[model samples]
Target chain A: MTGTAEPIVMDLKRAPNVHAATQAKGEALRAALAAQRTGTGLAAEQLDALPVPHRRVERWKHTPVAGFWSTPEAPSVQTIEAAGSEACPVPGLHAYRMVFVNGTFDAKASDLPVHNGVRCEPISMSDADAGSQGPLESTDWFAALNQAFATEGMKLHVAKGVILDRPLLVHHHTSGENNANFMRHDIHIEANAQVELIHWSTASDSSTGMVNIMTHMSVESGAVVALDKVQDEAGSLQHLAFEQINQAQSSQVRVHTGTIQGNWVRNDLNFRLNGEGCETVLNGFFLPKGKEFVDNHTTVDHRAAHCNSSEQYQGILYGTSSGVFNGKVFVRPHAQQTNAYQQNGNILVTDKATINAKPELEIYADDVKCSHGCTIGQFDEEALFYARSRGIGEKEAKAMLVHAFIGDVLEGFAVAEVRMEVEHRLAIKHGWDTWNDTLESA
Target chain B: MVNIKELQASIGETPILKGLNLEIKPGEVHAIMGPNGSGKSTLASVLAGREDYEVTGGAVDFEGQDLLEMDATERARSGLFLAFQYPVEIPGVSNINFMRAAVNGKREHDGLEPIKGKDFLNLVKEKASLVELDGRLRNRSVNEGFSGGEKKRNEIFQMAMLEPRFAVLDETDSGLDIDALRIVANGVNAMRSPDRSFLVITHYQRLLDYIVPDFVHVLVDGKIVLSGDKDLALKLEEKGYDWIKEDVIA
Candidate 1:
């Protein structure tokens, strides 16, 4: 894997003498992606037209995707039966299901739902898997690699005023070999339409590789959509899921992402509130155990007037794992009365575990109630001692305190089954505390 | 449940408890009244297995087991509870989850299965009303913005929920108002049993009027200087603790 030529590279905006870091990573993504395909049908000039943004791109400095992709990537995804899907249920999801094995969308093992306003289809089905899925915008080398050797991905849309009765569930299950899965999903919720979508991915021990994924969400006027994405795959899987939000006037969108188990999981959720009187809420909970690296970065743009947005993301990191969170609230020069508030709090149980957080506020207009705060701390010692003195052992005591740490975010799930699902994953991720002498000690 | 004989304790290099001895059987309520900086809190801390306080020389036997040898959680599992004078605030964690973990945790420690969800809710509701704590506050962050009286009431609510065999109420009456004081006293009264014991720590004698202590001990500096029946609280109330410090602790 080492001594490999230019691992992965990106093509920045091609400015006059870009920053040295950006230039270096751009070269890396280029080399890493070259092995995917040798100018496969798409001419070299056309591939050059593709967009892959590097560090200098806004909101990407801290995440550092250049180092995320391993030197030698995984084998290709011939096909897969995403196991444990039936046992891990999604009841209200009635839309067409697109199951991915490694990275190819498998329509055989899925049930496609029909509705007047909704359409779910595999993009490669019509193109005979030949046409290139036009360049990934502002994506990194991993995403570019996914586009290079990609097999199949999904495209979903909802018609205006035809609010679907159920959600569309997509299962991205990886298995059998160490492989690279690159996927790009384009989602559109038309005007005055309401929809719920869930992306659940699962993997076992054999599924070891890097997952570079991207999702684009566009909501028209008066549209409402709730998105919940959970990654409970094998702990050895390194993955990335990036999402961008394009919003219109009076559209309400709530996106909640919960990751209780994973290896290296980084997500960038960028929301552009391009209209006035728009309401947006983003809350997430990440409970990572072992040596997992979870980085979550979010940016909410107050592009219009009289708009309100709230952001809260909390997580509990245990063992030797590390987590990073950066939440930015941007109030454009004229976006007055923004009423934006953002807070991120985390608890590190073991001394070796760590969480780095940054909550920033950029307010351009006056008379706005925009405030942000971030905290990375240990559990309350007194509170732990109190619970322990009441017969809870060190681990359960720590879990109890941590359960308290993410209680607010967990309560915001709204759906009983989904809330409990996330909570159950949390319990399992930290379940080691529920075993051993400490379990009996409690 | 607790039986201590001539217990001596020290903080850092200075001694706080010197030859202090007491016996608390089930169903008996004993109050330790002392002025500020006395070993009143120290006694409670040591009983709760707080490691900061040194047991210079003492033997504390609870339920026929070596109380001082057990860790904080072990001592608690063996049926001991302490209501702190100041309950630490744990932000972002709801009261329901914390309470549920605690109840189930304690039950698990007793080698008993976890309490059912419905039954636990009923118990929480019953215990919550016993202290007049609002259900809405249970949904709020744990004491994140609770008032002084609310914290005290919360301590009592916790005590009612755990139902410990021996409880050490460390200054449970300190920041409480008259109404809160009665509610707390009523909660303790409801849990009174021939199989449960209490050690109330307080400064003002007002709390003694509601949950009257069976016996009162006036502590000054680091040692108990005087010990008497419940009337001793009223007498000390009228005469002031400085006099008791002069007569007994001297």
Candidate 2:
């Protein structure tokens, strides 16, 4: 609401970090320019045609890029030795711990997996990395940016008919002054292959910093893959993350992303079904307290016959934190029998906090089921009253209804541990003892 | 747990219940029968502290406190339970979870820690059994997919769990068949004690046969026009409300 004609560039780095970041960004760009690598050539070309996007672009319309630009200049680059641990550790059964530090692959600290037909390779100039999420074609601008600049990125691929019971864990930890970390991961799976992968992004510090990352995923026909992305960065970091989804015919793709921590962050996700009978699910939950800002924009396109896409995002905001959720679903002309659903729901605790929700549906086919809705509400007053009247207190009653509102989303999640832990942590953010005591009259 | 004196209540510009009076003590079941538009449900809503219904003229006391002054939830927490004729179905909310919150809410008000998971589960189990509510229904979302009988039974089950001091059975028998009615009545009968009171609101005497009320009142034109004993309910069932409105309140 302020009057400003110039790009509101908020400097993020102090003097020391800024100078090193400039040099690192330049070196990373030079590396990609030197490589004549293989990928969807179109992806790289798209990256070449576009400069670092500014506020002028409509696609990046609502996002505040100043948070990314005005950041304290990049911190001085530290060698892998200077940073103690490779990546933040999460306990579970992980087959491979692929560690990336400052966008460079730390091979010495990384653990390799024995699963056949699955390859984890680091591509700089001559090598190429691939994985099951999707094949990164050369044409994706974001992927190209990562390929040119990524000091370290992983390529994971699954062979047809191979199912890995354990999760392939990818860890990202960024540290240092001369930091311009970019990564492009190309994932591919043979037809009829099934893969389960968890991409864990976390930073060691809650101090102020910046991170911008994108993942490109393309799943082949008859392939089924379940992807879980968790963002558990500290509250003082500025995070700009994006993911692109491309699905083939008769394939099933499900994505569950939870925003566990961040000070200021914006994530964009796009899912496209290119073949018949493809099913894509894009679901997310964001819980922001304090002065956190978490924005998520998603688009799903049913481009072929019999494709189905559903998007549901739940947000719980407290304090002066604000959240924005914008979603769109499109049914192409020939996409008959397509079913697309999108909904965004937010709960605000304090008066100063705000939620901006927008849902849009575009249908070109007459015989399609498309729906979109957005709601900004607190816990249901009647429901709360009903519980309290049973002799429950105000705090306890509100907590009951809040858990009730989010129970549906948590139930739909595939990972039990993630869902349970999310509920536990979210309860804390809402300032309740348990899931049952954090509600107020909304 | 119940006291009523010259009870007067209204809604907006029109008066719904005018100069109505009734009384009940713990350990007694009273049935209030009336025809449509006779302020039967209004009595329940007003007692439950529904803000839309204005209690402009009547003085109501519940368990010795000013009932009308409290909010709906406060009224409920104060031992006033109204079993809605059409139970509000909260989507995505399981019955077990809902009851846990409610029971724990009540306990917390009494300065108690939350019910343990094991204890709460068993509590719902035993109470749900009282109403013969299907065990499977307890795990499903609250009233989300319930049938007529199931919804009524769930209402009674809720009452049993909360152990309200004064309960209003608003049209509990309206949609129930003979079997469901009998089960609901049995649950009510099981909960009868010297410390609790029941007000059964119905349009017919058939429910009276199951609930076996100690007093019967005929309500019409927003007022309790006549009061009698069990025999009065039999009389109204046979004679119909047309005669009661014309011969009594008028």
Candidate 3:
């Protein structure tokens, strides 16, 4: 027992072989793109050069995606045609809704009336091609896949000095077995403009589908942009989403991601403070139960002076489920007076559950304040016993504790309807209906 | 009413309450004075059905039912409350919500519906003032960021809301100033009724002065060595537990 331990080595040569089914899917995508004559600025050979995301990569070590490409997938063709459509979950939300069914924007089901200097339109093939220059041309397989096969998306541009009175809801609905879809949304907020945007997606439980999405957002000087994105898909669906944000001088951006329900979900949220005096707040919460796996990866790059960014990502894993949260913050040499804080907290409800949380801060500046911390713990026994001693039974007590654990992150949602909807879903999932009112003041 | 006969218990392999005996009738306040490690807190925890202490031997009857047979939640619903010496801080469970759940839990156990929203709010307002607990504290998380005195006062406020049939004040006066102690004592005194009973465990006679108990028992070495009236507490405080220790040993 006192002897030195041997190091385990993994054979990098044993890479996964490209499946014939995946190659066929790629050929089918190329043919479709060629028939439409849409230029994605990315050559088909470039996408073929990079292998799909797999467990061999350092970032994808915990979550395996090699099987995702090998599975056969077909495009979904369902459409929603009315305001009270069953596809839109948050019904009473008073927002200009853009409903996308099976990756295509349905104008009839949408209530978007371009009134307050805000332009809303579907992303033409050219628009999608223009935004595919950076990572999509490089090592990101998800981004490349989205750019190569994106069937539909939205382009939202808010003019300078305009404040939209209502929020904009972009709803994506998917149905059908073995369905596969890709989408991209580009949001450009001009100087001093303000808007609240909600991106929501749902899928049927019986379908073993996959959806890859990419979003590009730019917040200009003195602008305030708040976004609340929720992904509540089916247990058999696989979701891979990526969002890239850039903030200009003195700009403020608040983003809250709620992975309320999913089976195999991965979210990559990246932020860059390109100008001085910008503030970014990123909050995320995910609950996975019953063998589900969820991963959230976030990066905040501070390239300018006097910029502040804080991230709080948390997860609650139950049953045999597993989760991963990897948050990285970078402070460049010239970015002095940069204050970046990152925290990842997780709770494993059952002994069989697992969580891998890594918070990294790479600081090159000498005069900066950057801190990263991670906590992996279960329910506080004393607190649980305290509640139980007050007659709150075991189940309700556990629900209340979970509510308290994710209370602050839930408060990060900008829209009230979205927050309530997420809370309702959480209550239903955890049998918290009896104690739902306890969350009213939380 | 509560009855305890040779109530023996232990935490792990170490016995804390060895052959301890005590009884309390309706409307009576019994004060147990002892030195540290005399199992004052172990008794309170054992009565509240805390799982940490295992009942090695003995039986406890509360309202004609076996108290040791129920879990903590069942014991709480059966009208037994313990005001923790160091109340745990629940960061997001509001005091108002906690009390409402406790109240409704007991009501449901009695085959009654949950309390109405308006009535619950009124009850919170009335009970919070009993211990001088501010309205803001009631809305905040239970015991989170509360000062020492404020925590004790909040305990009394919860007791007022719960209105248990048998209450155990486990060193409720441990970290209180004179003013806060008087307020806590007054809150407990206000709830004393012919149908209720209390067992106040304290290290000093200072609390018994305000919430004056009917019977005073001296506990040493996990057993009661003397039983007297309120005058015994004054004697014990004046001379300290040294004389009682000598007498018990002899």
Candidate 4:
């Protein structure tokens, strides 16, 4: 019942000296980007001047970034042995798989299916072909770090009126112990283009690396995009990811972020509705067991009129794990007739577990319907009794109830195979008999 | 068979069932008619091993096993079933999956293999039709958004699926329309077997008219005052419980 210990304050300006090897790698990446004239990299001085967030910062209060950047050894981008395409976690998932190992693109380990009207390739600093100024680039500390140090990522472009038959998968596999990997992915969806994007990560059990990812997406008019991001890294790994989405008029976007297994994970998801008649749907769930910590911060800013956005995020914490969820919705004065709703729900399975949830809504428009709420509660005893009375064991009943609590968000996955894989993993880890798995096998 | 001897129970410090006694042999339907708060539901809950009702002193034997020693799940797996008066509505747990788990749980308890998927599906279809439960209700979350009659029928539907040796129906007739009452009664009647026994607890004699209990007991103040045949129910329905209360007092 006691509060957490006072956060440790670190002198980030002295970080360059301690992490000199990482700084030198960033300089090399900046030179490469400058040579290609991509204009995506920040100057060395600007990158050094960006302040790394600490516990004192308001947004970073719940999730401290100092520990995310701290390591016993100098964190540098390093490549290890590649396990080929068989290393893909979801073997049954059939997608255009692009595999990356320790933040570097592995061409031999990826299946690059060439389809008409789709340009998907590993971003190269030497080639200017897969180049574009992305729609949204955050000046935040984490994004700035990624912009300065990112060495390898993917650039995807879908031509107008093109609908992908299969999903595009960006799979990150980490094997570098005590190392840092920075990745940045750019996605461009032309008008009327429909595509589904899946970003998934897995790491070796012995790897205690740091993986920072920044994703920027732009959707043109009448385009529809579905994004499913899953982070199920090793318990020793630390993960920080930022996603920025810019929607044009009449664009429909849906995003589902699942932090199923991670020791420390922080996600910042922002949506900017820059056009009218756009529809934005955000659904996410996190399961933090043991001593894991997961923090999710999201913002949906409606700057255009006649836009609708709905966000729902929930988590279940067990053992001594803790979680934090902060969802904010801002409806500008000019964005009349905007309907924005946000909800955050959590369940603590153990007395030692905790969850801090805050849902904020700022509606300046008069003729708008906006609602935001949060709920933190324990398991439903009556429901538990009901299931057990029907002959289900207590532990199995609890497992089923936990899955049910997060079912709606998982159902939002654009790919069925991906959903089943994640569900199977969770069931195996939690000793749950997933009925659908049996039904499918039968 | 089920036997109860000096069954005493309570909630907190307040006693609900004070030394009630009852016994049921195989192939018999015994209906206990009582006034409000006469420990009718308490007896049903205690029989089903509901944790909230503590058995302060008493003994319950089910098929040669000490029933009170088992938890609710163990009792259920050991062939004891209770159709709740107010069936719990569990959202996000489909009725099909719940029933499958229940059926498999009992089978495993009896050292039998799990039911085949096709056979389970067939059983669900067959048992559901007994109560006129539609396919949609079978697929939806357990008892969620179900009407009163539908919830009761679902209970009987589950009873048919589980096929427990001893069944307790706690106020199964309340809040039911005449048509639904007949349908529910028909489902229960169809499941009557020589190997199974039932304790039907209700306030009205209306349900007795359809199920046709072999014996009728009048309960007042946590004790049974009189026991009779089917005609006693009609008499109690026509005469109202005042005469019985007077007789007990005298």
Candidate 5:
């Protein structure tokens, strides 16, 4: 996995073949890294050794990556100034802000406090070696690319028995056209500690871009952690995110991901229950309009006994957009008395809209209880008519029914600020003026 | 307040209400009783502008306005309400929120400002007590996990909240116990006014016992075959619908 320090330049005159796009991007990325002289700790041989996802791969079967890979690559780093905290989509949530622009940390716009036992600092390539897990072991192509090109990110640590009074808001803003931004975030919550972390990503202007993010989180025994992620990039951009979570004994972790607007978005989330009496909850809501596409693949591994996990993902597709949801729960042989539940529900507004949902439960334990359900349907005609019969207009009634359909997932958010922000975004997406007003007032 | 003349309707090609005619005056309670598949529910549905029941040829005037020309929501906004026999179970929608939307919708249609939150809450509490609806149900999802009796009482509670000028009770007594029936009847009686009327459609005379109707009509084969005063309901209950069916067929 070692190679010379020579730059591997890419040929821009190559034909636009999606099948060869991944190789072409890899070559171009190596040259870009070598030109900047920023060692990524990943050798060219290691990158080439990783397998790129294709149509034949089971995980990438539903979501096509041809267009994503074929898009023109942008420089990894840009000299754009980071927007102020006032520009955050979630107002009043910048109590402790960490801002990043085009994969470059902006200290001027960030608030790095020195709280008791709370540490927040940028992670360099040298520090990446100290982590237990590395991207070379990950089979995912996107994870390898992130490892090769990532230059700016954060490493947050909370000491044992310490609780942060305010949430840590990490803002990732993309600017400039054709920019390829790669980022990595790691969070470690020590034993008996409690903290809330929110990651908000948005684009400053309408531009064709690409964003790749990977997050690794660990929660120690008796700790509580809530991680909320919101992505609303430009419609012409593409995004790929990978999250890995490990929970210890008696620890509780909740992760909420809301995809409000994006052109092409894919989220890969995996949770590992390593100790007994752990609880993990995953809730997601995705809304795609026009020709946008969103796919979510999640896996929960119950490796210990007496663990509990529940996952629910709801999608509302409009126009000619499409969505995919694949949820799997695995109970190991020794994980007896485990409780795992998974549900995926989708609503296709127009006949042109499409959704593919799959929920699977693999249980090897005899005393385990695991169930999974998936439903793809339109709005309930009876419920719509019932609402309309009460003098509510057709549009408002439809919005109300849609809200009701996804209300459970929103209600599952443990953080009040995050939930309200999500509700506000939903109201905007569905054009519920009165509902938006009500949310604002509340 | 409502006048139906030569009302002809059908579901697909199967005719339901065949050239039916009825008149409901203000401050009056009219009961329509029939055996199964006798167009009793069809009449209620057609009046509430259910799209499934096509109006082949009919004209309905409510408060001097053409009712057939209006859609379901328009009819509702124009003060026409239907207490469904089987209220739909809407998950994750609070009962109070649903009621508030209905009230505000009606108010907006009347060119009035939205009701204040405090006033709306007070109204809900006052009207809910009329039907003895539990306070906990107000915050729960609409009709979700509700008992048969609780659903019936919720219907009446919703009716009181909307305060429509005219209400059509379609088999509202189908799944109610004795106590629930009395509470529902008491709610209806309490809402009665000089300018409001009700069209009660039922299969039994027990509901009419507490809230007596001014007139009774027996619908058979999609038409009213017998019309009389309140005595007609008791007579039909005592003799059974078989006699009415035989009379109409004969």
Candidate 6:
């Protein structure tokens, strides 16, 4: 175990010079830790051993941790009243709600009644047993930071042959300026069990805040799991999320993520297929406006033979916003008969907006099949002309085309309410009068 | 209802429609026949308000309104339609939704309320039968995976739904077989009324046997050289366009 030093000196050679902001943040974190009390889990000393990410790191190459991690301020506590179901964009959908405010579980705002074949509770650092060390043993900076400072998060377990009738909705709401939040969630689905999860993050007030969340999911043999995540934070907030998924033999897992609004957001998703006959699907859609920045990085490892995976990500950028997508697939030497596919497509609404996308595949088995494709361009002129010639206005035509471009990703959502909510949000973001009117009438 | 005078247009630096003049009154069906490069498509494109062509010296009047000043959507709303020679394929936009948008857009432009959902669907079914279009294809994406004959038939189905005052059929019979051509021509003839007119542009005169145009014009070198009745189209078909070029040179 690494011990905390009195005066820490960061390695400037290993860290990129462009991330001066992150260096300043590290100094602030050290100063804050010196003045605070230590916790039971991975202590501040273990976090000090992990290095902050720089441009040199392959995972963080395009998305530098400058303005997001640096300029840290003392964390502040806030009290929030119970919000109504209207706060949930997809109203009328039956779900088990778990609310968190400023990284602490708000029991009063949550609806966590006991159910059959399932257990749901919040675990603190002191209450977590030695068996919870699997996810906390990671050496990544973000994971270490989460393990060190996480105050409260949900711990869920589903018994064998149990099928959840309603989805689990986890809502994270932040308030107060300069507040930092750290959260961790662990979910385990037993053999032949099925579950659906919906996670959403939003800011209660227009304040500059930072949120770091880590989720660890394990699916046993013959189990099925579906997770849908939506991030619609205020422009003054910064968010970072990491999801680690592991699958057993014959397990099926699907994940859909939508980043409709944010200032600075990054999602790191990694899947480990350790069992043969496993299937995985990942779909993502992001729309950033103004000076917002959004990045999605995903990796799928096919360690066993006869596994399959497919991934698709689409982005629509407007104004001077920037977007990034990096997808990687790896097939080990013994992973024969593995099939993997990846695609990334982007549409820039304005000349000032930009996108950076890279799709990579590594295969050691000769019998495996792997392919990737990427496209970045403006709207099709001929399609626009065809729409206009049918009496559709220019603005409506553009909106229709954009909607069609992302139609596939939207249809991947198994929940109808979630799909409709996302479509409504997209219409409002793009200022489509025709769609707005149609939504109102509907 | 359409009048074109000395319509000189060019795409880039190359001139396509040079000094082309034509006129069509209400309740009249006219045909324009010419060789491959006689600018028949350019005439249709310029009238549809395609921005690629620069109108150097010409004027088009649709019901005495300046057609050149209006944009493509505005022209469609004002009762002008162009059945493209090669219809574009839109993968995610359904054919039914496309027709509803075209119909509702024109209605909205005329200050009318949008059509009801059930009413709009009934309208689509009625117009689809005019061209013998399949109901499955109507629900699919616009022109996606449709055969050549089906694509041409979809164009006519759209025209029927919009009910435009003036329609320019640019080679509607280009890729159709005998049976498909008859179905398409019947769809057009069924829509003919005193308030609407048609401009049938083709390379062969077989289509004239079905729609039976009242006037036929021979276009050569970006200009219409001869104007006569439907008998002239038969004569030109018997003697290829080379004779018309030789007559113009002499």
Off by over 4 Å in 5: A1-43, A71-86, A124-137, A436-442, B241-250
RMSD of each: 6.1, 8.3, 5.6, 6.2, 5.5, 4.7
**DockQ of the two-chain complex in candidate 2:** 0.26
The segments of candidate 3 whose C-alpha lies over 4 angstroms from its true place after superposition are A1-45, A49-51, A80-85, A124-138, A435-442, B238-250
- In model 1 chain B, the worst 10-residue window by lDDT is B241-250
DockQ of 4: 0.47
Q: In model 3, which residue pairs have backbone atoms overlapping below 3 Å? A: none
Model 4: native contacts recovered, as a fraction: 0.56
Enumerate the candidates' DockQ scores in order: 0.47, 0.26, 0.50, 0.47, 0.49, 0.49
- Please name the candidate that would achieve the greatest TM-score relative to the true structure: 6
Quality of candidate 6's docking, in CAPRI categories?
acceptable
- Span of 10 residues, lowest total lDDT, candidate 3 chain B: B241-250
Task: For candidate 4, write residues A1-442 as lDDT tens digits.
Answer: 0231111112342342334444444444444444643334443455656555655555666774554444324333333344322446786787888888877787766777588898888786436443354322565566776776676688888999999998988888877476567788888899999999899988777778578898888899999999999988873887889888989999999999998798889999989899999999999999889999999989888888999998989899989999999887888878899999888889998999988788867777789999987889999988888777778888878877887788889889889988888887787767777644334233
Writing each residue's lDDT as its tens digit, candidate 2 over A275-331 gives 999988888888887888888877777778898888889897878888888786777
Considering only N, C-alpha and C atoms within 3 Å, which residue pairs clash in candidate 5?
A: none
Q: Quote the positional error of residue A203 for candidate 4 in Å.
A: 1.5
Interface RMSD of each: 6.5, 6.5, 2.5, 2.1, 2.9, 3.5
Error of 1 at A429 (Å): 1.3
Clashes of each: 12, 43, 0, 0, 0, 0
Residue range A262-377, candidate 6, lDDT tens digits: 88898988888989999999999998999989999888888889999999999999999999998878788888999998999999989999898988777778898898999999
Query: Which segments of candidate 4 are over 4 A away from where they belong?
Result: A1-51, A72-86, A129-136, A437-442, B220-225, B234-250
Candidate number with the higher lDDT (1 or 2): 1
Colliding pairs, model 4 = none
Across all candidates, what is each one's fraction of true contacts kept?
A: 0.66, 0.50, 0.61, 0.56, 0.55, 0.56
Q: Write down the worst ten-residue block by lDDT for model 4 chain B.
A: B241-250
